[model samples]
Target chain A: MENEIAMEDKNSTFVVLPAYNEATRIRPVLEDIARKGYNMVLVNDGSSDNTLEVIKQVKKEFPDKIHIFSLLINRGVGIATQTGFEAVLKFNPKYIVSMDSDGQHSADDLDEVIKPLVTGEAQAVIGVRPFKDMPKSRSFANSIMNILTRIFYRVNVSDSQTGFRAITVEALDKISINATGYLISSEFIREINDNNIPFAEVPIQTIYTPETQAKGTNVKVAFKILLQMIKHQF
Target chain B: MYLYALIFPIISIIAIIWFITRYFKGKNSLITVVLWSIFWIIVSLFAIFPNVSSAFARLFGITRGLDFVIILVFVVLFYTVLKLYFIVDKMQNEINTLVKELALKNEISLDDEEE
Candidate 1:
């Protein structure tokens, strides 16, 4: 299994993380992924905090392993993540993985999250968590979004909100991420479903803290996502 | 009333003169100048001869000329508004494309890490 993985890593691959004002939480997250020896791209989404300063420190330590793109303005998660893709495409990487910068997603799940793709079982892989302890309003909102995804996009993944996802270069080159906001999660599913790209999910753990909870899923933002989903119904 | 009659003709004349100057200065397109000229001419004619609108209304079997004029005004406004919306949307899309291209160009590759 180890030898098989070395051969897979020989191909161009990268992990992209979208961060916004996560100056304090990003250190452990980047360090964990770097220790795993994966080429990474950290796209700072115009963070007002010392996030870019921290990113600069990481780049200094692992200059050859990590690439950075500091967006001059806060565009949103969709565009920031898209910028990550644009940067990774320059290296002609075959597999591109996207993860969060809030330290919620673990680097340990990277192998399993990309497992289905490694075995040729699926073109895309996403992380899933039960969220049994998830707050009431947040869980209810996720349930509503999950149902809407199934009803419209025909995607039945256990978790659609997880940012930890892997996709093939084929999927990336074909689908365009133009939503320009947080709606990219559902928009991502919509594209995969409409393009008939096979996908699977691996169960993963989510470590929530007061910081993560403070950045809750907002109702107004969710409404905007719904409107965009309806407008661009796949 | 005489005041009502003179008011529209005066406004129509001013608009027509303004449009002509704009067209000559290249601030307005030829089609725009022609369209507005025709619109103001008709307005001034209707104001000068109020019976013509009623006559045309009678010919078309409409209830009243004022109603027909009001309906025409709304239809033109709606059509122009829709056209403006498309123009603005196209401009916005163009700007987004340029931003993407420039952002990609400005990307810092790991190979070129600062020394």
Candidate 2:
């Protein structure tokens, strides 16, 4: 099922994976997306590890399909994803999907996430995860973000912090993200609301390993994100 | 006179001198130098004659000079902090833009080499 969708719109869709210090886990994620034949944009956020070397090695196998971008230093995930967007925009793709590199987001769900965009049902699509399936701490943090996003941006989504989402090129043009951290996810929802863009949410499987859970937003990061949102409001 | 009266005036004078030196070195504008000098001079006067603060406080309808001084300090600190916050935010945005552009430029050059 995923293969048919991938082969049909492979050239028009670009998958952007923003990775930071994912040297131990990035290869399989990249290979999975590559095997699906989607054009890949891998942004290395100045990983202190040998993540860049690993990306370069993977690029050797699919040199034509894989595009590698390296930040000079460790900018946060927000800017890293924005960099990927800028790089992929040059190629003029129809859809740009941003994913995490920690193997939390499944490559199999790529088709489902992009289905709304393909069918012209929505301009932007967020791959929502079942909160019940998430770890308690992460689930609690995500719930808080969801409520805050609704309050601040006046847009409600079950998951505002999910990296697994797809946006059409036209919709992407109307949105500008200035956040340089995890708060970028919230910024996306704000932009969508501000621009009056059509959006949808699809349920995606959540695979949380201990490493993945330990990496992304924790309680302290959530509090920081709340502060950033308030700052932007004023 | 109290010990703070002597110490504060001396500190204010030193600050005024430093501001003048910075102006002479072209690191500060004339307006900035004048404003800072006026501020420090006022500080020195308030420290030398604590009664003047009481008089000014009466003019502002405040009961105590100490209360007036505390309020003024807070206002100044708040303004300074807000100004610094905005400057830092602008710098962060500029740095992000520079870094993103550099990364994209390097990728374009690599593409050119491949072609």
Candidate 3:
């Protein structure tokens, strides 16, 4: 069953889910993707809970639509997503779409983002959430990240921190990344800018759960990203 | 009896320090020190104060003072494994990001060639 599922993923677009200690929400997200007929790779980022166990159970139930990779220790979200990104690279997918597993990102918006990648209109496409659904604090943080990317990377992206993004396997290979959390999303955009990969943004609806609102952007996270940008400068 | 009591505790204390120093110098040396210290402590206790050694050993479930050293070594080993796991996890992510970015660039070059 695993081999058959692996073969199925070889010919399809890949969705990457970077999850950590999200045993409660991950299963529903996995089921949503399976229903959409899109193959996904869930990177279990060293979650101390039953996150890996949940994925194993899902794999047993829906072997073809979901594949998983587990890291032994809890790394940050950036590392977990990168693990999924690497696995998708091996499968040779048409497009790679990565989203969070905390139930903040909608699997339904995937098509809107993947469209550009599928049509070759852009090398990478990001789904930007409308401001109405975003908290004021988060909106402000996103603006700060965008301005920083423009200053360092010279590219003007609407929302640099949005996780709903799709890129071709080719672009995924070229950009060098140096992030392990929220900053990774920004660094990815900077990579697209550095390499001059054509990128597009499509407006999508984002529903902010209580969990997401509580976990909103912070100054420490911003500082970590600034440090990452400094490292890139050198 | 008085002389034996004073010398035995002193010897045990010295043996424990020596065991810890060897443990710090190299991990491999810890096993040797622990084993030999356990042997010596047990022998000294029997020769000097058999009743006290037997009573302490039964209460602690450790045959000798040196057996406690082996337990300490296991604790350190477990902590080391947990620390290494975290470091490895972080490093793998950094490497993966590097690879993905490299792949992304290669795709751009291919696109340029087609253009």
Worst 10 residues of 1 chain A by lDDT: A1-10
Worst 10 residues of 2 chain B by lDDT: B106-115
lDDT measured at residue A45 in model 1 versus the true structure, 0 to 100: 83
Better of 1 and 3 by DockQ: 1
Overlapping backbone residue pairs in candidate 3 total 13
lDDT of 1 by residue, B2-61 (tens): 776898989998998999899999998989988988888777777888777777677778
lDDT of 3 by residue, B1-115 (tens): 7776677668877877887787887754766678757765765665576565556556778877445545645766787798798888777756665644543333211223247
The per-residue C-alpha lDDT of model 3 at residue B28 equals 43
Using DockQ as the measure, what is the rank order of every candidate, best first?
2, 1, 3
TM-score of each: 0.78, 0.91, 0.64
Better of 1 and 2 by TM-score: 2
| Clashing residue pairs for model 2 | none
| Among all candidates shown, the one with the greatest lDDT | 2
In model 3 chain A, the worst 10-residue window by lDDT is A1-10
Docking class of 2: medium
So what's the TM-score on candidate 1?
0.78
